[model samples]
Target: MAVLLGPPALAADPAPPSAQGPAFIDWSGPYLGIEGSGGASFGQHTFHGTMIGGRAVPDFKTGDATGRNDRSRNATTAVGGLFGGYNWQTGPWLYGIEADVYGANLKRPVASTAPGLGYEGLDPEFSVLRAKTDLYGTLRGRVGVAFDRALVYATFGLAGADVRILATYPDLAGGGVASTRHDLSYLGFTLGAGVQLALTEQLALGIDYRYLDLGGGGRFGLGALPGAAGGPVSTRDASFTSHQMMARLSWHPAGLTPPPETEGTSSPDDRFSLHGQTTFITQGVPGFRAPYTGPASLIGRQVQSTTTATMMLGLKLFEGTELYYNPEFSQGFGLSRTLGVAGFVNGEAQKAGAPYPKLRSNRYFLKQTFGLGGETEDVPDGPNQVATRRAIERVTVVAGKFAIGDYFDANSYAHDPRVDFMNWGLWASGAYDFPANLPGFTQGVMVEYNRPEFALRAAYTQVPKEPSNDVLDPRVFERAGGVVEFEERHVLPVLDQPGKLRLGLFSNVGNTADFRQVVGLTQAGLFADINDAAAATRRPRRKTGFYVNLEQAVSADLGVFARVSANDGRNESLSFTDIDRSVSGGVSLKGTAWERPADTVGIGTSMNGISPSHRAFFANGGVGLLIGDGRLRYAPERALEAYYALSLNKILTVSFNYQLVVNPAYNKDRGPANFLGTRIHADF
Candidate 1:
């Protein structure tokens, strides 16, 4: 089971106009507030040691031992704090200092297995081991900045935290045994950058990121039961850092004056809109290894590269609507030019000798979306035809559509969703913000459906042959099925706080129809039901899956997040051949990477796994940044991955990535397999 905490709390009131000595008190005020954050987090920690003090006596012979190594962690935290400050607003400068004390429930877990590898001589009485940490703290800070309708600020402070650790060792004798627990405390530092763009005198929206660092070289302990590997021993000290990033909507009551009735020119059309990011990847051939050349010249290497582009276009459709579009392309320049053409057969690569054969030499990644809706403004003077003054000023509703080739999310399995890279679908979404009543929060809902392409259906039925067995033989197979998706998101305020909380839930259902036609030597009565002639005409059955994510922000520069996803699927026609289930969860940190104003970056990672395709467990992460003025441009930071596998071949692997530029490169070396790959990605 997984639980997500809300975001962190920001200062109750806005900072003063100036941080200078006692002069103007134009911006001096006090207020009490609480806040929580919601997002995602990545985990990285190792647990490998023996146990002690059990019934196994001096030998410490342990039962229920999960002697596995290399695992990942994901967790979230909810922070509540109270703060108030005085501000002296002078000319075009605003600066002040605020202090806050916070209570946090942070989740950080480390999983390990040892003293019982592969359950050899191991008792089911003690099969699993898990660890988690709960923490809380108080923070003090001083801030400084300059500007009027907009401002740029830098803040620094010190924080104190207490951590509680939980570890469970399951019993092999049907039921589980009581576990071990530990607690500790530490001091850390926090720093980051933020910007605010005021659209109107009383309404504004902003984004921020923060970084936190807990001291290093803190030792921890783990001992075996009485009969385990000679009691327990002292383990290495634990250490790591975190990042947090967030987007916020703010509104102020009793600040703006009422607009004139039926006046001339009204306030300049004040507009506040938000845009999402889009990324496309194109792959012409399905081969992991380099294209095979002539018989003897096997000196070639398997390589893949994608040419990706991202752009921000003005979104405006009619009086109150938004629309946007972006497209991409990827192809094998060197490999395709050398081997002529290649074909994909059962996740394998085969070569050909021809200029642009029947196969598609080009692949495209495309996406198009738009919405119909309206916005709210503080000033409702006459010239402004679309003006309304209600306690809940903005009840913005938007509906749009989208289509894509492959709808694989970055956090899922490394491989594409379907064996092949092809899919197309559409989506409709809507969102609303309550400024007067709710202060700093928004509500949203979305739904989408993607149809399975013609080729994808063929590949699933084991009929993806050379000239497509469908052409020469009309009795090949029936059309595969399509997928339907439904989702919902909630942005709630942390009571009477400064920051906000976000929660999301999504589900997918895929329907597979029975094979309608058969090609070669088959009697008409042979495969009446797809299950009977499973070998020749295998079709699909209906399957459904779902996932959820929750995140929260503690302050303008600090936040914590967590996410959990699960899926269940089956291909009934082939004797329920491809029936599988998977679940994963992890935590994340945003902002606080750099000290300079323009160097804000977000770093995060997570751990999880599925059956069959996965032998053991795994973890992964991503880092991002806001680069341009008004944060119009985004940049990649870093990504990390580590996993352990149990199978015919056992091995521990570690992978690292540096997304320095929009197009980042990845270098990996695992046993006999070694290669370089470049990839680019974005989220809307």
Candidate 2:
């Protein structure tokens, strides 16, 4: 998120803007920069005698008291931040002031045990120390000497840091462990020197080293002992120092002199556009409910990773017709082959079953638009769009092999699993069981009518050849799915923000088994297994469902989204998950208050349930694509997820996510689980 502060560079300077050129480099003006550093911190702490009953216990010293309790630790760290400053230049001397803040992962823990400090046969003495430096900032003044295209500078600054300390004892007399944490703020000093080289009038790169001393001997009392009620029995002092080296990239927008005008003008070919994105996600559930008596219980404590790369190419073939193609490469499997949870943890974790990377022609489509004489809007050239003006009142017809979700059930905030919520139910209407292949796509045709305030959309897509099949049925007339949706967009006058609401009706016809039939056959003892009965009863069953979606912008930096969907549970799930009903909602917040506008935080929850017939089949040992806990203690599957995404730069982002799932697989007998995830994504 670095911003260049200078004007455009002059193409024809009296001389070239370089060290060897005739023009002298100007090191004046304000600049914004970003820096990354990797370093280590060194620190030491000293402990005093234990305090009990508001008095020092002579025999309870940590280690004979003469600095024997002193401990030292070192930690490796990584830090990154943004910086802004202005430089004043007079002749060859340069002076500047800069301010910056950084976030760091720097922590160390120390522990010790004492055998002689026990009370009533209980070892009541243990010392545990934990210290960390989470954040730090600097306000500095700089002095430098400038060369033609380079500058060498020295800096001194007032530095402030936040440090955390924790002390704990395991054997508290009555029961649980006793612990206390202290958050300390320290003001110190920093000194550094660096050299910068101008790559252009607007861009420069530099490397710098700094020594930071966060002062020493900040004393704090440790109140209460493990076995004895006390106050101020022991005291501790903590300090930290670090040597850091960072590489910086700075942009001076005001220093960029405009280039000379050229004689020829070339217009971009806006009719053709290409865009691509790549996302890599790794997620793990450290522990969950154990394996059940059933055949398809979830495997607890597992890690899985997935990667997807997609290239979207588009061409405007005619005034009202356009064509799009998306070729994608995908690798990796979901946790337990995407099993155990009715609402799976990762939406992008397709059922590809590929142990290695596989390439697929994911989508190809053609769209034609007819204008009905209305306001015009400019469309950006990206992905499937061409840079052109489009009539607000238009009818569009699309025929393609693509994911039905690409057009229908679209949500402005929650639909994209790559960027927004990642759970299956949160990303789409789970119970719709929309037609698709194993990777969630199918050949489809759609029609849409649009206006300033409302729109109507409908689509019919090919269903899988069989239940959970990896290929589409191909006989679109016999095995297919259709959906129609109406959308309304309006402004909330009170909030002064735009919002959209959508209602959709969908139906799928596929060679699927009826849940009640499977249960009925199992009870009749005609077949001992419900799956066998289900296979015997396979036929083209029609499942109908509907969904409601809403997205509201509460403010410029916050938004809310919600979805509720349900389907008739008579037929087996042909695509997507096993849930017959689902409701999900969440809010996304941008980090504008904290000043990192590119960062985002989101929290969401979903509840999924099966119909009576579907539950009975599972209770009688029937398995769907992802879930089958043999016998069922039926309970709705519920999950809560939250994530924080930090934008390292324009093309890269790192996100940390956590999900708590209750009654995974809709089996009350099985666990409430926890899933942690990390995602790295890049787009261009």
Candidate 1 overall lDDT versus native: 0.28
User: lDDT of model 1 at residue 66?
Assistant: 36
lDDT of 2 by residue, 422-515 (tens): 8887889878788888888899899999999999999988888788888788788787899999999999999999999999999889999988
lDDT of 2 at 531: 96
How well is each residue in 289-361 modelled by candidate 1, as lDDT tens digits? 3222222111223332222112223333344433433322111122222222111100111111111111221
Error of 2 at 471 (Å): 1.7
Alpha carbon lDDT of each predicted model:
0.28, 0.75
lDDT of 1 at 460: 18
